[model samples]
Target: MALNNTYGARLVQQETALGAGVQILLLALLGSATGMGPAGWLTGLVFAVASWAVLSRAVHRSRLSSFGPANRVTLGRATLVGGVTALVADSFRGSPPVTLFVALTAVALVLDGVDGKVARRTGTSSALGARFDMEVDAFLILVLSVYVSAELGPWVLLIGGMRYAFVAAARVWPWLTAPLPPSTARKAVAAVQGVFLLVAASGVLPVMADAGVVAVALALLLWSFGRDVLWLWRQSRVVRQQGAGRVLESVAG
Candidate 1:
């Protein structure tokens, strides 16, 4: 038990250190390529450290003996995300090299499924790991939305903010947090958000084409969220009715 505990702590520490190193390297690249300013560097560092803190907490809670191969892939993806974040921050100072920014995001998106496959193949799947993967995907989509929004208008933020809004709603309506059954449609919708956002940011598409692609992504996301919300509402209703039935039976007894 002591060995497992010690190993887990060390694993988290090592990964956190790696993330910090990547952040620094990416920062330097951004400075050279984009003329990143002090504010951009500060923002990127804060994002890197904040993400590390979340990973450490999740790892400790998981109590895993090692970081595992799957998690290593996720960490690699997260490193790429740090690079993307730094580039996005630098963009605020002035337009970043969009090609490099898009390339980092593209690699991160491609690796999204790799980590999940690695987890399945290696038998390392865990709730903590899944949640970590989902959040990274969410953050990437959110960042992409912010980048695209600068050109498309503020309405584009809805594409990125929807997941966060759902999470906030779950806090008020605990039933919304109920475990949802696996659905391919949900996965597909989530996957396409990054793709469409990438296309929008790639600058290869015409303005109308970008609008159309983003519109479709948003519609699918709305459908996905709507289905889940409806399912949770039905579940809550059933639970209430069952509780009422039990109360009536006790009174009769």
Candidate 2:
């Protein structure tokens, strides 16, 4: 983690360099305390560095408006993810470590929304901030998905699958690089999905008991995506019509 952090052009930035150092140090402490040994420490340190790199960039770019609050919250979220991961790992005995992982995952998921909102509210919105937030989200989700899939046999997880699918499609279709634009409905669905996932992961639900609950949540996400797709299609038509009408008016005038 230290080597990679201080490597390349990224070291040119003071914030990145400093954040990396801090991350490396903390990761060592985290590993030593958790009895995660050298390997686990290295893995966790890598994650910590990644998170620091992102948040530091966001800070340096001045994209986060409510830094006071956002920083505190994100730090908390990070602690939760790392702490719970260790706890669950230690309890490799009874029940699934799914509960700890899920709880940690929830914090990461929730932080996604909180950071965005804070940026908007504090008028600190910027490309750097968005990118930082997005990277954090992608990494968190990816890690959690990998862990979950390892624990619970993969059924049909769109969280990880959708990201890979979109990325692959983007490579083949240049136009896929264009964003589909944000939608509140999509955000709502994402939030709900996280909630249900966390709850199920807590192991609070009976093995067969939460099946209906999980199913319903999945259905909701599907509907949300379907609705948003239709809305975006209509919006495209409207945009095209407006452009055409403007051209005709200009020609006539």
Candidate 3:
């Protein structure tokens, strides 16, 4: 048993190391193609190191014997996201290479669909894989939002920050951590955030039209989050009431 655990840990470390290697290689290519600046290099390096560390820890805790195919797909998507993030950071120095940025983001978003199917088909789905995928999706949207915010306004940040905000709120209100019932609508709303942001970033639309598209995305995200929060709040209230009822019964007895 101990030997198996050692093997699993070693395997996870190797996979994450390989992921970091890929991230560095992508950054090198971006630098060569675009003369990416120091900010881009720094940001990409930070992302690679952080991703490797966090993913290694998570997999170790989950005790997975192998890093599965679905996770590898998600990791690849994450590498693309790192490139996109570096490009966004570099944009502050000058105009971004819009075509390259869009291409990387597009591939990442498309692969977002592929990972789940791979997981379901392979029967290797795990909580760690799902969480890894969700975090990558969220970070990519956040990066895209930052890029668009430069054009639209800071108000555009709400689209990127909402999920992180919810996570912070959960720290205070533990009930917010409760498992939400799976809603297809919620998933759809989450999926479109990237698409909407990508369109806005593509610079093809008129400013007014781009703002409108992002505004709609924010509204949908607001509604989806509001519904989930309301559900959790109601569930918490029911548990409290049931606890009180039990106390009353015991007192009566």
Top candidate, metric TM-score? 3
Which regions of candidate 1 deviate over 4 angstroms? Answer: none
Per-residue alpha-carbon lDDT of candidate 1 for residues 1-253, written as tens digits (9 for 90 to 100) = 8987897788777876787677778778877877777777887888788988888877777776777888888888887887787777767767778788888899999999899999999999988889889989999999999988988888889999999999999999999999999999999999999999999988899999999999999999999999999999999999999999999999999
The true-versus-predicted C-alpha distance at residue 245 of model 3, in Å, is: 0.9
Give the true-structure RMSD of model 1.
Answer: 1.4
C-alpha lDDT of residue 224 in model 2: 69
Please give the lDDT score at residue 117 for candidate 2: 76
Lowest-scoring 10 consecutive residues by lDDT in candidate 3?
Answer: 4-13
Against the reference, the lDDT scores of all candidates come to 0.87, 0.56, 0.96
Query: TM-score for every candidate vs. truth?
Result: 0.95, 0.63, 0.98
What's the ranking of the predictions by lDDT, best on top? 3, 1, 2
TM-score of 1: 0.95
Question: By TM-score, highest first, what's the ranking?
Answer: 3, 1, 2
How many backbone clashes does every candidate have?
0, 0, 0
Q: Which candidate, 1 or 2, would have the higher lDDT against the true structure?
A: 1
Q: How accurate locally is residue 63 in candidate 2, as Cα lDDT from 0 to 100?
A: 32
Q: How high is the lDDT of residue 192 in model 2?
A: 67
Error of 2 at 23 (Å): 4.0
Specify the poorest-scoring 10-residue window by lDDT in model 2: 87-96
